[model samples]
Target chain A: MNRDPVETLLRQADWAAGPPSASRVDLADRVRRLARRRHRTQTAVRATAAAVVVIGVGLAVHSATLRHRLDDRTVALPPPPAASPSPEEVAQLRSQLAQLQKEANDLAARIRSMTAIQEQRERLARMERAVARLESGEEVRAQMERAAFTIVYQADRMDRELGLRESALRAYRQAIRLFPETPSAKVARDRLAEINTQGDRL
Target chain B: MVDMVNGPALALDGDPLPTEREDDGLVARLARGDQAAFDALVAAHQDRVSRLAYRLLGWSGDVDDVVQEVFLAAWKALPRFQGRSSVTTWLTRITINECRSLRRRWGRVLHREPAETGRVCSPAADSRMMNGETLGRVRRAVAALPVRHREVVVLHYLEQMPIGTVSDLLGVSANTVVVRLHRARAKLKNKLSDLMQE
Candidate 1:
């Protein structure tokens, strides 16, 4: 491509000449200042980042050690044993036992009275049977013995209800001995056999 | 028709340009933060950088500022230079880019001030042109060219960079540079035809 005229025109332009030597020196000094500033900034940033990392690591290690100590304290201890009762507690328990024994005796006496009332009802029923036997011209003595056996059986039931097992066995033996020929005596003997077997099991 | 020069050889202040090896060594030293090396580089290349900025940016007070910025950028970017292109070519590219940016940034103000707008006449040509009126007219005509065409003309004619170097600096193909130069010269010929007749 041809460029003679354009080059001539450009060469004729005085402003196209290079800058003076003094300006070059000044501009170089400015560049050096800028470079130094940039380097300092980079160094500050790196130092700050490193310090932050170190502090963060130190805190993490400290907290981990504290947590480890807490775990050790929690895992190392054994549980305490249960405490025994005091003398006052034992005395209070003894007094409660004596009061329970007295209540049981009173309940036994009330059951004995109820048994006696049942015996009285049996005697009245025997009397009614004697009257009935006399009116029918039957043996009244035999019916009276059967009524005695029934009273003894009812007494044994009352003894069993009061939790008096030995008394119930004695009453049943007495009923069988006093009226051996009566049907109620046979029932009493059978009850005595069953109670003996239960006692033997116990 | 203009004369066809063999290579785009610019003779600035009649001083010898640095060899390729010297430029490489200077760039290496600058990368290593050698302030003396940077000063030497500035002394060697500042003329070309400032002259390019002056022609591209016209007669402005900020030409010194642009030159400072160019060197500062060069110092910062020295580490990543990689020696792909000569340091002068790289600095020239940066100077052109900075000039273009300054133009766009202050375009409105520059457009309003006709006297302060582009004027490129040599100090020696002042006596020949009788007060530089004719040279000022030609300079204004060259500045009035479109930015792309004007860039090609300034780099090719004023800066005297070879077609390939201009291509490398502008990051365009050589054919594109030739075409832009052709269009710019045609426009300049038309604009200065009356001056030539005079």
Candidate 2:
């Protein structure tokens, strides 16, 4: 008997069928990284708030500190200079104000990036995971070999263009492990042999 | 939006599914702040959540954020989980609510995609039916479905949940679910009249 067509069609529309748990480790890493980034952002905001309060305490605190520093230096009474904040104190406050201002701008930029390219970043992640999934899935072996080598070749070319020799080497090695006897694997071996004069297996 | 944080718990007809029973235990451990239990909970249920999200939402958009939010919300709310509904059911409710919020935020309902931009271009991701003129209509029809009607269809027909079970999971009367299913199917048949003829 034919199965229900509606159900089958709907199942086919399952966009959520991700590559599976092999990517779970990567996902977990992303989740952790995102959570940590959020936490750091919050901590930074709190620090900025605290620094602002310190800046608000302003001249009295500066004058008091100046008095204390003088007292510590002389251990004898030299009357306090003026109630005015010394140039150094003003300079320190200005430096801190500048630092907090820079931090606020940096945080804004970060938050903007988080929102602005978020959709694009997620789409890229999906594509990456799709490749990772296809590489590991139980598709036809011959087709998989072809697909695997293409992926390796692209990765190799991109890494080399970016001057990432180590990454390109790693990619070829990984391709071999994942798709042994594939065309790319043989090519990778020949390439490695070219790098190493010894004829022994790399 | 379904009240995932607090509201009526989805009753499973006085009998929890086997996974729900397991969820009860996992909930207990989770409330105790067991990290492994947290990992187990995510591992077991994320796939279902992801599928529900895709069904309720559409083929486009960033689903990973939704999944991340669902699990994060579950973790934060687990301590208060009363075991009234299974964790999975609670998660489904949360997924629906999240999808609703997303639709509201985006000011658009689910829309099917054949050549949608930013979709990463994967034919393997598409069903053969999706490419057909009639079946493309079917995708639009299903995507056009109001999430309320879509909910019953996804939980009942797609998930193969029984009527009573679906009713309890949605916190609605069984008759209401039945009515929704009938309405949804009628709409589908109307939309895909040519396919129906075949």
On a 0 to 100 scale, what is the lDDT of residue B26 in model 2?
87
DockQ of candidate model 1: 0.10
- For candidate 2, lDDT tens digit of each residue in A94-175? 7866776676567567656655566576578668867866787623554546455544554444344334455556656667
Worst 10 residues of 2 chain B by lDDT: B7-16
**CAPRI grade of model 1:** incorrect
The per-model DockQ list reads 0.10, 0.09
Among these predictions, the greatest lDDT belongs to 1
lDDT by residue for model 1 (B1-198), tens: 323333645543334566789988987887787879878989898867776676776433436678878888887787888777878778887888777777788772142222221122234333433134665667677778888888888777656667877787888988999999999888877877655422
Which whole-number lDDT from 0 to 100 does residue B41 have in model 2? 78
- Compared with the true structure, model 1 gives a TM-score of 0.50
Best by DockQ: 1
In model 1, the runs with Cα more than 4 Å from the true position are: A1-3, A14-22, A35-202, B1-8, B60-62, B108-130
Q: List the lowest-lDDT window of 10 residues for candidate 1 chain A.
A: A15-24
Q: What is the TM-score of chain A in candidate 2?
A: 0.27
Clashes of each: 7, 0
